[model samples]
Target chain A: MSARDDILGSVRRSLRRDRLSDEAQAALQRRIRAHERNIVPQRGSGSGAEIAARFIDEAKSVAVTVQPVASDAEVPDAIVRYLAQHNLPARVAMAPSAALEQIPWASRPTLEVRRGAARPDDQVSVTPAFAGIAETGTLMLTSGAETPTTLNLLPYDHVVVMRTSQIVGSYEDAWDLLRQSRSRADGLIDMPRTVNFITGPSRTGDIEQKILMGAHGPRRLHIVLIEDA
Target chain B: MESTSHRFKENAREGMANPSLQRAMENMRRGFPDKRLAAIGRLPEFDALRDRARDIKNHVLEHLDFYLEAWEAKVTAAGGHVHWCRDAEEARRTVLAICRRLEARTVTKGKSMIAEEIALNPFLEANGIEPIETDLGEYIIQIRNEPPSHIIAPAIHLTQDDIEKSFRASHRQLDPGRPLSEPHQLLDEARSLLRDKFIAADVGITGANFLIAETGSSVIVTNEGNGDLTQTLTKAHIVVTSLEKVVPTLEDAQTILRVLARSATGQDYSVYTTVSTGPRRPEDLDGPGEYHVVLLDNGRSRMLGTEFHDMLRCIRCGACMNHCPVYATVGGHAYGWVYPGPMGAVLTPSLIGVDEAGHLPNASTFCGKCESVCPMRIPLPRMMRHWREREFERHLSPAASRYGLGLWAFLAKRPRLYRLVNGLMARVLGLLGREHGGFRHLPLAGGWTGGRDMPAPEGEGFHQAWARKRRERTRAA
Candidate 1:
């Protein structure tokens, strides 16, 4: 027999042996039914830009800065200008999303755009979040064609350009959105196998309760809140 | 070997004396719970997810026989071996026999609590095969000859200075005067040291976070990626886990994962979530040639048909510990044994017998904080009460305690006599405490007064106070 078939057969035998009494089974089923009915819906209001600004203020980082995306036409230019003002060299990494590509860069000096691999010192990396949760200021990033999970962790400074339309109030709202998006495609929502919820920059207090940033992951996070992008 | 009771007292004394550990614990107490609350607050569906996760665990436990059988079949089909041991001794024997067959000399372990439960390291060493603990925290404790203090953190009690001191004493070829002060330096030193051992070790052993019944796979989640490297590099891979770790499907595992990291370290997920289905396939590269899983029963089967069965739903998240006032003060080692805190208080009694571990149940203040934060929502205090009942049934209570309880029961059964006796005692106690309205010492209450003074009760008890108030109201009306 194949490995899968053998596993299934074993499961059947084990289940028969360990099956609970009829009364207990029925009680458990009722409990599960009650649980499903009482599940709460996620939050509904708040734009991505507003959510980003709130998170930045709450983070209270001395080094990191938060700024609003000027316009859809000038989003890329604004990011470039911010990096230049901070005296950081401009060799930015871009996510393969249409929203990211739509940033008008044809008239500007050729910015080196690399794919697949990332370096530690890379000045800026721009990625579009799948959804932004307004409740706790979390960016929900899922692995897909447009946004690879690697872009978020690879650079020194990360610029998460979240559109106002994609902002949700809670995780449940994000899941609802994801489930709806998945049902449209054949194999989209089988659980991306991985969904990362990044709250803030990487930090540790292992040394005498001294808060040190950039212990392992990115030290600085720059969230560009795009209005109606 | 040091008994868990002895270890508990030793660790408690050390914890009480160590000011640095106290300060560290104080910080952790506020940090973990606050972050968890913030995280849960953001996710409106967190309650729903918790409920779903609990249901999934319950379903798996009810049909555990089926899943275990299925797992065995799949594992066997994939050229892996499965052993079911009814107790710890049997489990130890099975592991030893496997090592003997392979003539294994050295075994490198990847932070397995189950292995500690079986006392695998001492058993291996007694049989002449050296066992090395490869996890950084485990390695430090192994050198110092100390048991792990915490489940997840392990060395949470130790400061960087303590670690440096240990390294200075142990590392033969090291600059004694050099300042060894960075987390990365310590991590790098451990990585270099363990990297060689990982390659040369005859066997690799680990514990499972969840065993997937659908695929006969064992899943391990680790932050350092050490578990992955340990299993992949070794010729043989062995998983030692209790029967309760099994879940029916990958979806169920995912639901559990959603809460697991959040409860443990406030992470969405650990760095690596690995699923190893039996030995490496013929076409696979850099994987173990032989795979084995030992499913330990060890009193767990007996717990299934008892009231304590809900305790099996625990995923070992340590949330109960994080929120526990006693654990926050004394830390994990105080409870003594493989498991600690509220979960440990309930579990140790069953695994080690009520007579040997009866004190654990009574250690709680019944503050209900543990149950409130428990992701599985296992009523921990209630379970501890069940163990206390068992201890009473076994006639394990002290003679004085039994006599006191007997007298109290007699009085309780006869309300008139109880009221008269209590009234007399209250009047006498009230007169004695009239000066200060409290006592520094009380007869037959040494334990209560040993550390602190007890506040004197009011002149009237609740029943008398209530009755007089009612009479006054009726007269006015």
Candidate 2:
């Protein structure tokens, strides 16, 4: 017998059953398909304006800087201002999302914006978030032709562009947004190669329980919020 | 890994006597519990979420076989390979086979207790492949040639000076004269050192926090984004996890994730929660080319429907240990296994054997703190009692304790004789120790009172006092 058969057989014997009955299987399948949310805390729920305020507060608490822009057209200027404020280099590796590309990179001749997955040499990178979870100040980025997972990890400084309308109050709402964004004939879309929920810049408290940032991922995560997307 | 659980008593004694270990453990005693309580205070529905979390795990375990089958199908549909291994040997071989096929020279790893269970690093090194631990804590302990003392924080046992020493010894190229006093200085050193490993690695392996059966995703929750870099930059990504990690859907996974970091590190949510479904899609610009999962069922299949079946509900949050008084004193290495503390006391036996780990169950003081704080609400104290019973049944306990228990059982059956014997002995002891009020030592009970004085039995026995009070109350009425 194969390893799978042997292991499953032992599990069956331990559970004292031949197999799951049709009714049991159907109930489980239905639950999976429905994907019902359970017991989401009311803490994250509020008006959209309240959520946006809470998102900034929570994100700041975790050491992420949030900058608000009046519109998508203003994102490039906000990012450039942030770069200049931090005295960081003007070079950035931008994820190849259509939403991000529409921001005229040529408008800023001083900014060298390379579009693709981040290289080790890149000091900063900007990626468009699929959704923003206000509950924990998390940016949800999905891997695809547009946004590679590498764009979120390799760079030292990460600037995420999230539209104000894309922010959800809770993780459950974030999942809902993911499902609605990509509508197939079926309710579910196969998960992209990776769905990353990055809350704050990378940190570790391993050494004597002292908080230290910039362990392996980005040292600084700056949020460029498009208020009028 | 190799279990020194049989040497628990000696190890615990040495752990208590060591000044450095005691100092480190003091920080944990204050840190974990206080932060968890404060975090719990912020969330009004923390208890309710814990109940829902327990229910989700119970439901999944009841239909584990079916869910495993479903997960396997989804993984295949997503173009990922799933390998089922019945034992640690098979699991190790399965991983090595993947590495050999890809001609991987070096493999970078995220923190995984399952890798420790199979002793995978040594096994891979023996087969001409180098395995690197990427997490800061795991990397610290790996350099020192020590197993992780704590699950969530592997390097908690070490001080900054300890890390500086290890780095100086291991990183010969670096200047040893540089100041490395602060935490950030140490973190910066490790980050620069491991970045090359992440890029040069051929394969990346991580342990799954939860395996989603609905979408075929292996989710990892980490504060550092090293796990993402390890998997994304490599040619192949492998998830080495056990059978019990699977939950029914993304929603169910979220329910447990809600309680996981809050209970462990007192964070609302970890910095990074990444879900990897499979290898990169055809249109994707960057990701691994191959995705493989080796599902090990070493002794977990047998744990289902047993006295310790609830052990599988654990999410490795380390709350049980944080709250356990006995664990607070002795620390993790004393348990001498991949797991430590209250969870280890119950799980070590089931994974290894009762005979090897019998001392762990008996080591507890039955504080019930572990059960009260357990997010899964596993009856940890009840299971420890079961292990003790199993040990007694197998005649594994010492002979003197057995005879003492046998005498107590004899008296317990004869209530009248028990009361007479107890009253006379109490009166005699009360008279004998009238002046001193306590005894420094007593015959046969020397072992119990070795640490401190045993208070002398004073006044009438409990039954006599209760009877007299009852009679007086009845007369007054």
Candidate 3:
């Protein structure tokens, strides 16, 4: 017998069922289709400014540096200031997202911005987050033509420019937003090739349980939180 | 992958004796449990979430075949392939076949206990395909040519000095004067060295934290983001995970994720929780061109309706081991396999066989700490007892233990005889040990007294003391 058949057959024998009953199949399908939420944490379940404040607090606790920009126009100046503070380079690989591309990089003459996917040598990369989860201060990033996944993984310093309005109270809220936005004709959510929920810069406690940041990904994660409604 | 599990007593002795291993285990004992408690304390819904997570897994396991079929259809719909393997040999061959077709010379791998279970690196290297572990812990152990001592912390048995020595010996390009005193410096060295390998690797393999049947998405939770780098940069991404990892939907996966990171490393969320749906889409500029999921059974199917079925609910959080006294004392290597501690005690026997791994179950003290901390609420002590019973029934237990139990069983059938023998023995031992308050040596219990003194029994037997107490109470009334 084929491995698949043999394995399935064994499982069936153990379960004492020859095949899935019509009722059983329907129930299982219903469970998948419903995709119900279970016990969302109350800590990040607040709304409005509370969620944003909670997000910043949680983010800062994990050693993420959050800069609350007053508006979208202030993003460029904020990035420059952050880079200068961290002693990072003027060069950055920016994602081609409309929100990021609209930023007036021309105003900053000293900054060198390369658009599209990040190169291996790129020291800093700026990408727009799809959402910010308030529960864990996680940035929800999706891979696309505009937001190349490499921009999230290949750089030493990662700058995420997300608005306060983009921050959700919980992971379930974020999932609901995704399902609403990307529902296909078949009713299944058309997920991106990759959806990364990044809470902080990459870290490793592998060596003697001493946490050292930037093991394989970004060493510094700078969030320019634009206070936009 | 070889079973030193049979010689668990000897392995445990060496594990305890090794100064470095003892030091590493001490750090683990101090670190994981406290952090987990703090993480869970932050969330009021932690226990409720764990309950829901257990229910979801139980539901999935019950309808596993149905979910597997549904998940496969979804995977194919999303332009991915699903390979089914009955055993480790088939799983290894399936991975090799994929690499051969891709003409992959070097493969970058994320941390996978499944890979360790199959001994993938050696097999791939023998086939002239180099497999590089990208996770920091796995990387350290890989270079050292040693199996992971801990599941989550693979090189938890090694010290910073050991890592520095390994790097210096293997990385000949390193300057003699370069500072390697700090963990940061070691991390940076590995990061820079592995970056080129990540870029150069033709195939990238990873293990799935959970496979969603809803959208054919495979979820990976990692603190270091090596998994993301491994899967994204390569031409093909091969996920070598067991069949039991599948959940019904993304929401179900999320419920498990809520408890997973907290239980594993005390993080509310890992630094990176990435969900990959098949290969990269047509419009995607990055990610792998091909996606394959190798669904490995390897004896899990037989565990479906058995007494050990709850063992499948493990999410590999390592919480059970973290809280286990036996694990804290001897460390992960003493269990002698890819998995360790209470989970391994129950699971190794089922996967490898009780005959080969009988000593693992016997290694536990039935402390029940592992069960209390287990997110799935797996009755670990009960399963270990089951294994002991199985061993005794099959006569796989040592003759000494069987004979001792046989003598107790024989005497216990007759209460008068049992009481007479016990009363005499207790008085004799109590009188003998009145000075030291314990025995330094014993005839039948050499194993118990080998390491520490066994406390002496009281002078009177339990029945004699109980009768005396009852008579005194009646007279007073």
Candidate 4:
């Protein structure tokens, strides 16, 4: 047997010999069955930008800037311009996506774009969202070629770009999408393994429930809702 | 107070007598479960998420060795060291050795359950190293020379008035005449007192919520910025976490985080979720110089390949305790361990051995409120039963109880004998309790009858009454 199979075999054996009552064993099986049933298909459709706007409005209670992208090349220029307009530092963290890298920044001397890695002092980081849930204004970030988890968390400010088609109505719809995607993929559903649903910037009420922004993570969260990108 | 069992009884007695603690517990009993249900009610997919989370945890446990090695590689690549400890003693000794090597005189600590498991504070003090708890709740308990009663709300047992007195006594440098009544005033005093310790401490220790194997990072989510301050401002940063905290990716961590705060305190997300990849990079102006991640096995690894593997899925949300009827009445300290409530009942026995903590499992009313609210869906009652089974197998139970149970089980299995015995007992009880239809005293059942009267059987047993009713119906037809 393969190494994985060997280990699993031993686990199965050990579980069978365990001293649990028959009723307990049956109850556990039932719970597992119920869990399996939840992974089935569901129907939902919504616009990512509308979801993004609603989330940004509800979660942050602040004005948001929605940017539309025509070509991949314009992405970097748009980011640089936005940063420059805000008078932010030149360094920007970009997600590990082919589309993110396609942004032509060779001519922009002032802009220094780096690959997604956590640095203590990076001013702003940009990443693409795997999906966006309109229900709670949550950006569902998954680790893969398109988005790196580090870029979303490390910088002082985080800017997430969501395509309009990737929006879902609720968390259940999100799970259905994930389940379908994993079923289609080969070799045990290599799902990004980690999916982060970010609603707002890092905050703390620890110091006597006094609201403190940017306690340990990012201070500001900016969502760039892209339409027809 | 030698063993946990002894300390547990003492703490329980003290907690039961403390009126303020009783009041606080009553507030918690009403607040937490209601908020959690409301939070869960909003999300139809919460059940699905919990299932997914349980599966994710199971998958991790199944492949823990591979993942741990993978995580170690990532952490080492990111300029972090991962140390594997087999038990609490080893973990404490390793941590102390690290401090001794650095000649660390003062240490600042973020809230860590593993540190409590190892009894790290006392060990540090014995070694002449001063350790300060930075979390407000932990700091209060530290001043009072007590272990945390609750996992999240460590000093929940202490009232504001109690805190005022403790603050006045402890903050000697402050003006003796000033009135310290307000909550904010006490917080400000604590902040000022803890600020210098945060800045001056040589070593900072924390606990990990999730360890990213791919990135070699330790992630912590807290409301108070204390965790970040403790890690960033110190010269050395140490994270003590159980082996099960490792997750494969940040997305997985987020999925867990989504449930964590909602289960913990009804918040969608905690105030701060910090991910520390390594020590400060060369370009960084401020951060820890040396970063260490201590992965403690502490019976957890053995649990990975056992039936208790599901217990590893726990995120330490303490929902089970908040909703548990027994826990709400007695509070966490009554369990007499670092972990308490239903989760504690199962885990303490597993970690400390069933023989030592057999009473913990039996302390529950088995109402199943704990299982229903548990975000991880750990079958807490079933696990408690497992502990009971282990205790029985070892012949650790009292002889009188064992004999009673054995006889009862035998009679229960045989319906004829059970009915005959129960019928006779019921008639006797009815005759004795005709005055009030109840009894205040019963042989070998004083433990139950002591606090409240046992209602006598109304008439014949259910089976006998049913038979008589059927005979009368036949005669009428």
Candidate 2 TM-score, true structure as reference: 0.98
Best by lDDT: 3
Candidate that would win on DockQ: 3
Clashing pairs in 4: A55-A137, A194-B251, A194-B252, A195-B251, A195-B252, A203-B271, B75-B216
DockQ-derived CAPRI band for the predicted complex in model 3: high
Candidate 4: lDDT over CA atoms? 0.72
Model 4 error, position B109 (Å)? 1.3
For candidate 1, write residues B163-200 as lDDT tens digits: 77787788768677766787656655665577667767
Return the interface RMSD of the candidates, in order shown, one decimal each.
Answer: 7.9, 0.7, 0.8, 8.8
Residue-by-residue lDDT tens digits, candidate 4, A1-229? 5433343344345444433456754554343223332232121234655554555454454222456666556666777777877789878877767755655668686787777554546679887777766555556665544554556655667877666566675555665576567553332233332355565665543333334455444667776655552
User: Ten-residue segment with the worst summed lDDT in candidate 3 chain B?
Assistant: B454-463
Over B425-462, each residue of candidate 3 has an lDDT whose tens digit, in order, gives: 88999899889899999998898799889888778889
**Location of the lowest summed lDDT over 10 successive residues in candidate 4 chain B:** B1-10
lDDT of 2 by residue, B1-477 (tens): 788999998998888898888888888888988888888888999999999999999999999999999999999989999999999999999999999999999999998999899899999999999999999999999989999988888887777888988988999898879878877888989999899999899999999999999989999999999899989999999999999999988889988998998999898899999999989999999999999999999999999999999999999999998888888788789999999989999999999999999999988889899999988899999999999999999999988889989999999899999999989988888888888998888887776777568777876799988999999999999
- Per-residue lDDT of A109-210 in model 3, one digit per residue for the tens? 899888988889898999999999899988899998898999998998999999999999988899999999899998889989999999999999999888
Candidate 4 lDDT over B265-326, as tens digits, reads: 77655655666777776644356778898778777755765657789999999898888887
Residue B314's C-alpha lDDT in candidate 1?
A: 90
lDDT for A203 in candidate 4 is 54
Give me candidate 1's TM-score against the actual structure: 0.73
For each candidate, the DockQ is: 0.10, 0.88, 0.89, 0.09
